[model samples]
Target: MIDFCNVSKVFNTDLLKKDFHALKSVTFNIPEGKTIGFLGANGAGKTTSLKIAMDFIRPTSGEIKYNESLGKNKLEAFKNIGYLPERPFFYPHLTGLEFCHYMGALTDLSKAEIESQVNVWAIKFKIDFALNRHIKNYSKGMLQRIGFLATLLHNPKLIILDEPLAGLDPIGRKELKDIIVQLRDEGKTVFFSSHIISDVEEICDSVIFLKDGEVVFNGSVDQIMKDNIKPETRISYFDGDSLLTEVIPNNKKEEYLSKLLKDGKEIVSLQAEKPTLEEIFYNVKKN
Candidate 1:
């Protein structure tokens, strides 16, 4: 398991003479074998949290700790981790195969092992053909595929991806989503950030919604869907003669709402009044 203890981050801008609190006292957790979707708007400090967990950047004040020291080896912590940045920087001149090989080498894998693993994932992602082409010629989706293969070559237990579905066609998006589910089923912990709600809804077992620099919610997707904390529901009938008060009574609002929709009995409109992640984030900011 990973823990973020009162983690906070601030950035200083020389021109403005002001500080930007990218994250403020943000804390959350990712239990093993679970898929967590970090949902938020742009500049929500999701990236900062991921970076801190990976040790890419030290927290401004707080610390990130693990359950067991993965030995005294610093890189060993990475042994169980695979990371893909929001926009992964690649050596443009290197071919896709070369890049994977390089990452494998950095992880201290044998050359033969790199070749074997790279071939497996590269084939699965259908990027084997592009493996020989220079990365400069790769499209955004292609680059993401390459980055994914490189990250998975070591078979890490934890995978952290940032906006991985950013620039892909519909088919590609579906394929990657399937891959994420496959990994989760294999008992690997998957953590990623995305602005795509449908994707989050589809693959994530739970989510951590962030705004500005704080965590607003951390729980299962079902909890957000039920929205029991602030219960609300909408109902409408097709008949113009039907009065609003008759179709919707405050006392029976939620119960009748579901019953009417499912029974398909002349219901003109229906809406579940649960707050979306976006709404929740804005509400948190508002408070």
Candidate 2:
């Protein structure tokens, strides 16, 4: 668990350009054992925020607070964190298994522990068969899979992933999403940044939506949807050989449905019009 309070970051560019404000007093919380999605478009400060959270870069102002459960100090607490950057560096010559071992060693995991973990997760990640092949020979999806294996090698309490689903095919994305759900099931805290709104909506309990370096929304997915719900009902009906669809305001829905029923039209389906996360994101951005 972590609390990012009013964090801001500014980058100074050369000569003619003005200082860039990558983050503008952003604030959000990563609750313990929750899958928190960082949702934003490109150049929207998602990566900057993650980097600041990881302490890879210092914020220009404000502070990030870690729960004592993380550790007594920063160094000790960081040991319990597993991070996968958007573009992770890999040794081209090293085989997948070798690469995982190298990463595990950095976390001070024993060789036996590393081996056992690799054996278990490799099978789950569907990369077991290719573990002995050089990473250079692996495809992009394969590389992402290996990177994930390495990240989980230590079983960190908090997993921080930047664009973890980037560049993967649909099947690969689904596989990785399944792995993330598995991690959440195991009660691990996952804070991942992604531009993919639908994927975030699928697996995340809560989300932090950013726009142009500002915090637009931060809370439960259900709450946001509820807040922006459309006050309309959509109905489908069959009349003789034809099917008709209608959108009615909530106040008039019952009256409209009664008339359709009185007309002897067969009602096929009726439901409230709900906005998707994508729609909500765009609406928020536009406003």
- After aligning candidate 1 to the native by TM-score, how far in Å is the CA of 161 from where it should be? 0.8
Assess the local accuracy of residue 145 in candidate 2 as a C-alpha lDDT between 0 and 100: 87
- Candidate 1 regions exceeding 4 Å error are 69-73, 228-287
Task: Give per-residue CA lDDT, model 1, range 1-287, as digits (tens).
Answer: 67899999888868668888999998887888899999887898888888898888888899887645332345667777888998776999999989988999998899999999988888888899999999999988898899998989888888999998877899889988998999999999999999787788889999998877888889998887677434444666754566342334456786786676676557666555556655655566687
- TM-score for every candidate vs. truth? 0.82, 0.95
Best by TM-score: 2
lDDT of 2 by residue, 1-287 (tens): 78899999999977778999999999878899999999999999999999999899999999999889898878888889999989665899999999998999998999999999999999999999999999999998888889999999999999999999998899999999999999999999999999999999999999999999999899999999898889999999999989999999999999999999999999999988889999999888889
How well does candidate 1 match the true structure in TM-score terms? 0.82
Clashes of each: 0, 0
